[model samples]
Target: MDYMTLKEASEKWGISSRQVNYYCVEGRIPGAVKIAGVWLIPKDAEKPIDGRRKNIL
Candidate 1:
């Protein structure tokens, strides 16, 4: 299982690094694990939708 750091995930997801951390902290991101105080997100993990933003369809 290939894992990426928060910084890499943030860049790939086109969101702020802090936001990625927030998702990890909230358990919104699946397959996310914390090791040595560092969050390692799966490279293939889908980006979580922002609940704070309204989805106008």
Candidate 2:
């Protein structure tokens, strides 16, 4: 499996690196592993769904 750094994932996902780190820490991204204090995310891993709540009338 191909793995990418947090920065790469962030850029590919069009999100902030900090947000990617948060998602990894929160277990939102499957197959994401931290090694030697660095995050390795699978290149094929889909971006996690947003958790924001929406108001529907």
Candidate 3:
């Protein structure tokens, strides 16, 4: 499965890295995996809130 790093996901979503981290901490985004002290977001995972396939900017 393809995954995007926190930086990559933040860039794609037009959000700051801090905001992404907050979401991860709050469990607002799904399919986030933490490995080796890094967060990975699945490329095909749906956006947490609305079950949408696309990320909100």
Task: Return the top candidate by TM-score.
Answer: 1
Q: Residue 2 of candidate 1: its Cα lDDT? A: 99
TM-score of each prediction: 0.94, 0.88, 0.71
lDDT per residue for candidate 3 within 1-57, as digits (tens), equals 899887887888877888777777777778788888888888875544534356759
Higher lDDT: candidate 1 or 2?
A: 1
- Superposed on all Cα atoms, model 1 deviates from the true structure by an RMSD in Å of 0.8
Clashing pairs in 2: none
Off by over 4 Å in 3: 46-57
lDDT score for candidate 1 against the true structure: 0.97
Per-model root-mean-square deviation over C-alphas = 0.8, 2.0, 5.7
Residue 2 error, candidate 2, Å: 0.8
Clashes of each: 0, 0, 0
Number of the top-ranking candidate, with lDDT as the measure: 1
Which TM-score value belongs to model 2?
A: 0.88
Worst 10 residues of 3 by lDDT: 45-54
- As for candidate 1, its clashing pairs are none
Between 1 and 3, whose lDDT is larger?
1
lDDT string, candidate 1, 1-57, tens digits = 999999999999999999999999999999999999999999999999899899789
